[model samples]
Target: MSDLIPGLPEEVARECLVRVGFDQLPVVRRISRQWKWEVESPYYSRLRKAEGLARPMVALVQAQPTADDAGPAVHKGSSAAAATGGPANFYRMVLLDPAEGRWTALPTLPGPMESIPLFCHVAAADGGGRKRLVVVGGWNPETWAPMNSVYVYDFLTGAWRLGEPMPGPRRSFFACAAVGGTVYVAGGHDEEKNALRSALAYDPEADAWTALPDMAEERDEPRGLCVGDRFLVVGGYPTQAQGRFVGSAEAFDPAASAWGPEREEGLVPDGASPRTCCVVPGTERAYMLHDGHLVARDGAEASAWRTVAQVPEDARAATTVSALPDGRVVVIGSACHGGEQTVYVLREEAGKGGAVWARAPAPPEFSGHVAASLFLEI
Candidate 1:
């Protein structure tokens, strides 16, 4: 029944409270019972956004810093690395503030386990005011065997919970995307190393899985994106084709729970991995980074990727791209193969010209190989 703060107008008090940075929100809740309710209220988030205070947080499952770390590394040493199937699973989640160039790590995942599974699928979803990070499927750290595990992290609680394990045979390298609090997974190889076309949708809230129609192709290592209202599986090699990737892509309409006819409209170029393919949030625009160039998948016009910018010289070799909510992109990678990793922020020049890349200062610990990444505009 009290105003947000004693002596001030409720509106003025809210404006001050909302201006508090996203990182400080957790602490703000402990200030007072009324303050906690105000910030935790769903409308508080909308009001903060209206006041231009919401921040898009970038999260990465990056390779952990090792004991013998030189300055910045993208992989681990022989003994330390080999424990997690080379440099893949030996990673921990890190958070980066793209605008401020700040780096921090997420809370440790549950269990005695120190690292995430190798090649795990990571996705972020903000539904009903709950910002959650979902990590699913990958090879076991010690045994290197395929796992159907699922883990969910709630930003509000700053803790992780092991969700229901993925149903069916364990798989690895699958395509995954999050939409409406549900995570959709398709393709990847099974425990016996067999490619799969099957797909499933997971509701972390219910801890349940719903089987969807199998994809038209037996994609081995496809990539996924949630573009608009659809989930797209792009560019994966069939079991018979092996390493020869196809340019075709498949789209799944969650509303109808059915896949559209497979299309070959250049989802990814032939023989290239869609590993670098991504969709920028807010803009909801898709993009692909291949060779040394960044291409935007033009949705409103041609439904194709147009060259937007060239990858920064330092990040050309092993690039991983995650876009801020405003569409400003942050690329992290090494100059050459197995080289020191670094950060670069990219912006578009005016007049539909091109892009500019600025080197961002990244702490040595956060400057490493990015196994998986996503952005949550919370």
Candidate 2:
């Protein structure tokens, strides 16, 4: 045990090791075999959380701070790029540690792809004790055509690698979510611009995708969520009825390997987009930005939604409402269309006066447009 860290008591060494930030872990693991095993042990991360040392990090697909790697301002391009019309701005992935006000830029997307697709969706899930994030399907930046690409990022290795792309028939604006280490995607438009009802699940561990049964109806640009163990595909317009949302939601039961018959209605207002929505971690209940408020959907089967808190006014426009693993909701966006992007975190368990939104200071480099954002605790 003394070998764990030259001459130090094992328990004291462990306490020092557990306090190391996630970004510094890859280096720490290389110090020695004993140190590697000690940090990678299942209990290492658990101890960090129990001791309040685990930091909640947010990964964002945002506009580049400089003129480098910009893309055209098109239908599916980043809001930041379109807002600042002088030049096409390329989107890159960045990680932010709000507690420390630190930002880390991830390696650029692989191959000829210069930036993340304009509308590609991102989902985070646990993979063998390491935090994993996946980015899937959006219009290719180079060609402006739908792409079937899949890219996975591992926090432990601090690298990006390509995964198996979605099976044929590339789609766009699909709803996606991760539940129990599996990523699910459904209800988006096909290569022919036709809406689709098909669904599929991807196992990051196996680097494979398996098709699920079709939904009761075809939907385009729907919002996907996980409530408890169910995958909820909600509020998208059918193929021929573009821009006219159906205002209902359906659930996929993974255990039964089938979608249930019932669908809850009033999930969204007619003709409105449901892009700003996310599920609360652990509880698996839905939360979203609705009518200037942050609200949580009642449960897996009900249409009821209760107001959680008012979204900060600056972030009310063009918002990506995601709930952190710590049960805080971080709203990322600007005051109005084309405004500087900022972050506001809502503490769900605040002492009184209802939960309040505390604005996290964002540096200019991290303030470009946000295409999508997801939370991870490591």
Candidate 3:
């Protein structure tokens, strides 16, 4: 490769080949030989796609720094610190680097329960180089209650397996994305009561559970997305009517199993009370943070809903919004008032009335637990 691109320094080999991922950077260019032709050059692959650097800003598996190297430290604790008790308050397996805002915390989940609230949906594996990370399902304290048990978590083995489960008993659901390997659980509110249109899928390589074709509009905290392969469900409030947030919208097409017409299309932008969303994988745009604003949709063809940014009025009934692969958009640990909780991060600078809202850096521990955020690549 022309003597490894004439001796290195192409923006530090394109940020170490986009943090070591271009099918594993030729084993770090075999120890030397001018970093294996400046990371198998092509001008470091067009300066790694004009600096969009494809993927991997985080992929976590740390915990080897000893001799006071400051290893295990991500204690921004407080999801009410496990109610200030004597044991149960755990955390480890972290990777929050919104372009270096920092928090690494990995190593520990060999299972005895030292951490498990990174709440489901953290998949990535299709030549994108392996990733799973699924935990935080319900009950199961030794089968004392509700739990369709699922605990995959294996970013190439800091391990923990046992996938496939979820034909029933899920815990407050509404996740949307993860096509081929399955996982598209939407609309849930069961303890044996209301809300649940039953649209399941969890096929981690056929460990199995498949029962799609449901949603005719029976949302609980509705708001799902998968754009390209189709499965866009919006708005919630199954029933508990006071005016239950239901502007409606549906579209599920797993290659024509059918499900497409439920359009009420109501309040989606600052109309107040629909809150709860997640989806930014490969993008067509979709963000709906409820009430204080952050409603956007670009699915197109008469699909209008905008307010782009204005969060932090304590996030009005906050239901947790997270979509960070660096394009930034986050809201964590909801539910405020006395048992306080808040975490926001959305900044689009290039100033003069663009996109702004920043408060992130205040989770010394959360209260009223429930915080979800995923984008692991490294």
TM-score, prediction 3: 0.28
Candidate 1 stretches with Cα past 4 Å from truth are 1-3, 30-36, 70-89, 300-304
| Cα lDDT of model 3 by residue, 152-203, tens digit | 6544334567675676656465545555445567775677647877777666
* Model 2 global lDDT (CA atoms, 0 to 1): 0.78
Decoy 2 TM-score against native: 0.86
Candidate lDDT (C-alpha), each: 0.78, 0.78, 0.54
Q: What is the lDDT of residue 76 in candidate 1?
A: 52
Better of 2 and 3 by TM-score: 2
| Alpha carbon RMSD to native, model 1 | 3.5
TM-score of candidate 1 versus the correct structure, residues matched by position: 0.89
Pitting candidate 2 against candidate 3, the one with the higher lDDT is 2
Name model 2 segments beyond 4 Å from true.
9-12, 67-87, 261-263, 301-303, 308-312, 325-327, 348-355
TM-score of each: 0.89, 0.86, 0.28
Q: lDDT score of model 1?
A: 0.78
State in Å the error of residue 244, model 1.
1.2
Query: Count of backbone clashes for each model?
Result: 0, 2, 15
